[model samples]
Target: MTRRGVIAAVLGSAVAGHIVLGVVAGGAALTAIRAYAAPPAEPVFPAPARPVSPIVSPRWSTERARNDAGEARTVIAALAPLNGRTVADIGAGEGYYEPPLAHAVGRKGHVIAEDIDAATVTRLARRVRPLANVAARLGRPDDAALAPASVDVVLMVHMYHEIGEPYALLWRLRRSLRVGGRIAIVDADRPSGEHGTPPQLLACELGAIGYARTSSRPLGDGVYLAIFEPRALPDTIRVCR
Candidate 1:
């Protein structure tokens, strides 16, 4: 009868069975969940009211050039040690970060490389299949689709500005973080439309969706690395305009 009731009815039916269809939201028919491992009982937040920047390109730079610049190592150093921990590489376009991260995390550690593009995920899966510890999977624009409390660190490199539904995405992503887990985001100091997210705007958007910035620093070449920990989600999340 009410909005919450409708969402509950839709999600509740899915949890009870293998599939559900025709979820109505925002006066439009949304594709129902084909499968759900364990859907959260928490309410889903509305989409952000702000303008989302476009995804300019898949590969920001070549792996050889980035390695020569020591980009991945520098970024990895900003977060807590990854040895024997689980790390999810969000927006893993070409799987550039997989090798270095796999080495850092050690053999006991695990890496989940995710991309929204199905083809990219398939290619990435094949590329990393040789590595015993890394697995590649397709993700969604509004949801990282990570397992709940399964990851120690979530890494987003040069891809934060491309997320269309920041509010909804972050809200869902927060559930994937383990206790004391942190999110690491690397981007440039510029407008999102220009293929970079300004640090202030980034903070505003993340803060609006219940994340606290732990530390941020410039990582040379006009790029920056910011780390955040999840905080309690507010009753209603505000959009950064």
Candidate 2:
């Protein structure tokens, strides 16, 4: 064999011996090789300076109870004139507002029900399967994952406090809103750790990312509605503590 061919043969034999030894050693060597050969896992964005509440459960409360309290109706009313508008329900756990929003928006309009949990997204998809105007999909903790300039209204009901990367999420979500679009948030006036966001803290966090509050009003029972519109983003984001 030529010198090059001889060198190749030796290398091949060494590799073969390594595999044979790996097999004899119960695959530990092979596992180590594979571990080094595998690509790195995807990186996740870090949380902002503020505290993020843990997601306790998918359902905030029973549908019957919320309905009885006129929660959905009040929130829908706060978003007035929903007809022919594209609306997105971010972190849409259990999709409590999908049907009513679908009805309010009419057949000409559309509703996107999005959640971060895969199982929740699957359930939402099944629940809204009959509604032709609604689409259910999965999202990420740090992103809404909606189309650019596609929605006229974004509803974040009882879930804003649980966003892990609130700053990054809101910054990315601004691209999804159309001209004259607004984000409607319904949360309790409490600390984020308590499954609610205080109105002042919410304003500070959103304002840091260039979202201006269009309106803020009480919906009773500790829940409040705050509407925000996107403005020019600052060159550097100043995270709220």
Mind giving the per-residue lDDT tens digits that candidate 1 earns over 24-95?
A: 242232111211122346565666554567766668877778988788988887765889999999999879
Clashing pairs in 1: none
Residue pairs clashing in model 2 are none
lDDT of 2: 0.85
Relative to the true structure, candidate 2 has a C-alpha RMSD (angstroms) of 16.1
What tens-digit string does per-residue lDDT give for candidate 2 at 27-120?
Answer: 6555444322312232343466666788888898888888888988988988989999999999898889999999999999999999999999
Candidate 1 C-alpha error for residue 164, in Å: 0.3
**Which sections of candidate 1 miss by over 4 Å?**
1-44
Predicted structure 2, TM vs. truth = 0.80
